[model samples]
Target chain A: MAKVVIEALVARFPGDVYDPYEGAGGDDCAFVQKSKIVEVCRFLKTDPAMAFNMAPYITAVDYLGAEPRFEVVYNLLSTAHNHRIRLRVKVPEADLELESVTTVWRGANWFERYCLDMYGISFRNHPDPRRLFMYDEFVGHPLRKDYPLRGRQPLVPEREVKDIFRGPGPVGRD
Target chain B: MAIEEKGLGERDTGAAPRSAGERPFEGQHRPETYDGPLDAPLGGKQMVVNLGPSHPAMHGVTRAVVALEGETIKEMKLDIGFLHRGFEKSCENVTWGQCFPYTDRLNYVSSIMNNVGFALAVEKLCKLDVPLRSKYLRVATAELHRICDHLTLVAAMGLELGAMTVFLYGVEARDLIYDRLTEICGARLTSNYVRVGGVSRDAPDEWVEKTLQTLDRVTELRDTIDALLTRNRIFMDRTRGTGVMSREDALDFGFTGPCLRASGEPYDVRKSAPYLVYDRIDFDIPVGAHGDNFDRYLMRMEEMRQCDRIVRQCFQQMEPGPIVVEDLRYVLPPKPLVYGTIEGVMAHFKLVMEGIKVPAGEVYSYTEAANGELGFYLVSDGGGRPYKLGLRAPGWPMVAALPHMTKGALLADLVPTYDSINMIGGEVEQ
Candidate 1:
């Protein structure tokens, strides 16, 4: 299933997709150029043989030290074909943006917003690009590799209560 | 939904009177007729009502900024994340094994499913296959959790819709199942019963017979509730046509599980991509034609029956064996082995101090979670902890489609619609 799709993809869009091959996990994977992501997704969704209709999950993994610092992964599924394709788009730290694929699949709406809120990788033309999980007052992307796990950024001022349980945080409580 | 560009406060431009015997709207298709919003706007002005993060009847912390033209919802904007505790960020800092408890909290109603889903993902990364007995046990427990989840949905649906007896029946059935679950996992709400390679424990003696009795009672109660609400005049009137979605629109919105199935799509992860012992089971996926709240309710009710069948088959087909895999690296050694041999002691010490070292790769594993498709995309870097864990929550798409579903529908219909979506805040927000 993956080989057929990959071969067709490479034949159609010669310069856009990179490293088109089945991943070690048996999923058809391709690292597409960031700029042509929407085009690729639209083509995949509309293509008869590889009708990847649903963009079920989309996430960005922060490779903090790598040259292209972030990898935005799109897990696409075609209920018609019963096959899945994972598309990864590399984004540099300098340009933390990618064109939105909302036009192709409406389901990518919140996933893109979640990516923006959690990883700080903004979608260029998302209709409602507000933070999906975190508050507007949130300081930084919480899911980034550099974001300290113990970092406490509260929405409200803390109040002094009795000693709870001892655990890891900015201020230890016992 | 090509809705009018008019503000909620703006007067209704649609003056066409409604035709009798006309059908309720479907999909995101905005109705053209100016149906009176609760007997035509009270003062000819649209009212904006905020349904809450704190209000009763809301299954979880979710806020919908609804613009009401009378009682008809003109537009809606959802403000969520009140229950968000950074599930992804928290799990990334913990060991792969520690993440089980975290996943358990994702869908607290049927937490075993979340645990199983995450465990399957990790097992995929490790390329480890669990024992046949373990697979059967996983299927049995997961099916029981499915019954519990559907029971919760039906109970809440009935309670919110003014059928209090149905809620009581639903809860009664659920309590029996939870008691059976507690006997096995030692926890009620969050059962962290799954490990990387297999399940954490085996079933207690006579547990199968007791569970069968519980399931019989549950089926009885479910039948009563079904009779009470499925065809009842009030329940049918409210849910039969309200919250309808077109087949194409549902797919476009990335709906999975019952919602997608209720939308006339016969796509079920269990049937399409069988995992665990699902391929061995013979069951049917209930498909709805109307794609409305009633269909979704019926879908869950029928699925509970199917779950009963799956669990019974599991108990009958399963044979006693080691629950976890024999892999010393992934599974902890038995108590006797740890105290008897130096090799076992070393393996136990290493396994406890340092978690299972999964090969560095990524895998997207999905399961037929109660609400929809609960997917876990795990990225490993050959470390004790996971590189990234992205949750594709089943209820997220349904919640996102609230505005679209309620457009031009009556205010009273929103309750059943919301209830039918079965949005568990833990998973959706996380």
Candidate 2:
């Protein structure tokens, strides 16, 4: 079943697909260029022959010394066909950016934000491209290989509390 | 804060020179310069209020800033991450087998399910097959945890909405289930009972009997809740048509479990992609006509019954045998063997020193968790520790779609709507 879907995908986009390996647990995994992710994903989601409706998640793995330092993975499942496929996009450290797939599946919004928050990978054209899990003031990506496990930072300053019983600004009357 | 005072004669002299078409004050003369309460706007406009980062109805530290025009909510924005503990980052540092305890914190209400999910993901990566008895036992434990989770959620939702009796009954039933869990495993709340290959311990002699008694109690409680809330005018008025999510919208938001089933899509991971002995089980998938808070509540009630049936069948079919795999590489040797033989001691030492080494690959394992599809995307570089671990919590997307659910609903409807979704703080923020 996976071979049929992979073959169909390869026939449509020849140069984009490469080194299709049967995943460790029997799913078919194909490596594709980062540039073609959005297009390929849209096809896989909407194509009549291979309609992969549910996108379980989008995550990235950082390979410290490899040429392409990161591999962004998307796990797509076809609810209609009851089959699964994995798409891995090699993302170099220097250019750690990929097109956003929120337009294809609205569920991808937070998953993409998580990838950016953990791996320092940016997604172009994301509707709300703010940090999801980390606070606005958090420093470096904590999930990177170089980040120290016990690294700590100073706490954010607390805001002053207002007096609830008092009416407006200053207490004294003019 | 200084209070602005009106002039001494302002109250009596309020009737200013009337314009051509202006009407006089109705009865009593009103003060010309009057300021309303501090929180309300002076002019008639939408009021902005923060619901909670620590309120009881929020389940945990989750804040929702709601904009209201009178009693109706005009806009809502969910602010999360107050409970973020960097679970994925922690997994990167821990050994493969050591991550099980951490999974317990994800969905504390159903900690055993999270443990099972992580164990299954690691087992898939290692290409290890668990024993048949263990398979049935896993299903039994997972289903038991599912019922407990649903009971807690229903109880909390009821308590938030002033149903004291329902809360007491639900918690009582859940505590009974916990007693059984404590017998099977050592702990009740965070039962790290699942390992890479199999369960940590076998069931006690009276475990099945106790489970059957608890199932009866839970069913009776479910009936009481159904009679109390299903057709009651107040409960129906408050929950029906509130936070209505259509099938398309539910799918677009990546809903699963009873919530998605209530939306009329039978895309259960157990049915679509059977992992354990689910393929052999016979049960009906209950769905709802209108995906509203009421539908979600009723769907969970029906699911608990289905889970009870699954547990009964598991005990009927399960046969006595080895609980863990026979492979010495994955499963730990018995204590007698370890103290009696030199090879057993060496094996124990190696197992403790070096955790199970997974192959260099990736697999995405998802289960029909209490809330929805709880997925674990694991990437292993042939090391004792995982290269990367991503948890696809169902609550994450549910929290993301909260604004959509509460857009134009009444402000008071927010609690029931949010509670119906069952957004766990640990899972969402992780």
Most TM-score-accurate candidate: 1
Candidate 1 on A34-134: residue-level lDDT in tens? 99999999999997888887888888898879889999999988999898889899999999989999999898899999989988999887999999888
TM-score of candidate 1 against the unseen true structure: 0.91
lDDT of 2 by residue, A15-97 (tens): 89877889877889899888999999899888877888767778888889998999899988777787789899999999989
Q: Which stretches of candidate 1 lie over 4 Å from their true place?
A: A154-174, B1-43
Q: What is the lDDT of residue A143 in candidate 2?
A: 83
lDDT at residue B97 of model 2 (Cα atoms): 77
lDDT of 2 by residue, B1-430 (tens): 0001323244322222111242232211123454777655445466677778898888899888777666678888777889999899888888877888889999999998999899889898889989888889899999999999888878887888888888999988898999999999889888999988899999999889989998898888877876666545566667766778888777777777888888888888888878879998887788886787878987888888899999999999999998888766777789998999998887777766776778888898888889988999998888778888989997777778888888777777888888999999878887
For candidate 2, list the clashing residue pairs, or say none: A168-B1, A169-B1, A170-B1, A170-B2
Specify the poorest-scoring 10-residue window by lDDT in model 2 chain B.
B11-20
Candidate 1 residue lDDT tens string, B34-113: 67766442355566676887877678878887777667888889999999988998888888888999998999999999
DockQ for model 1 equals 0.32
Tell how far residue A46 is off in model 2, in angstroms: 1.8
- Tell me how each candidate scores on DockQ against the true complex: 0.32, 0.46
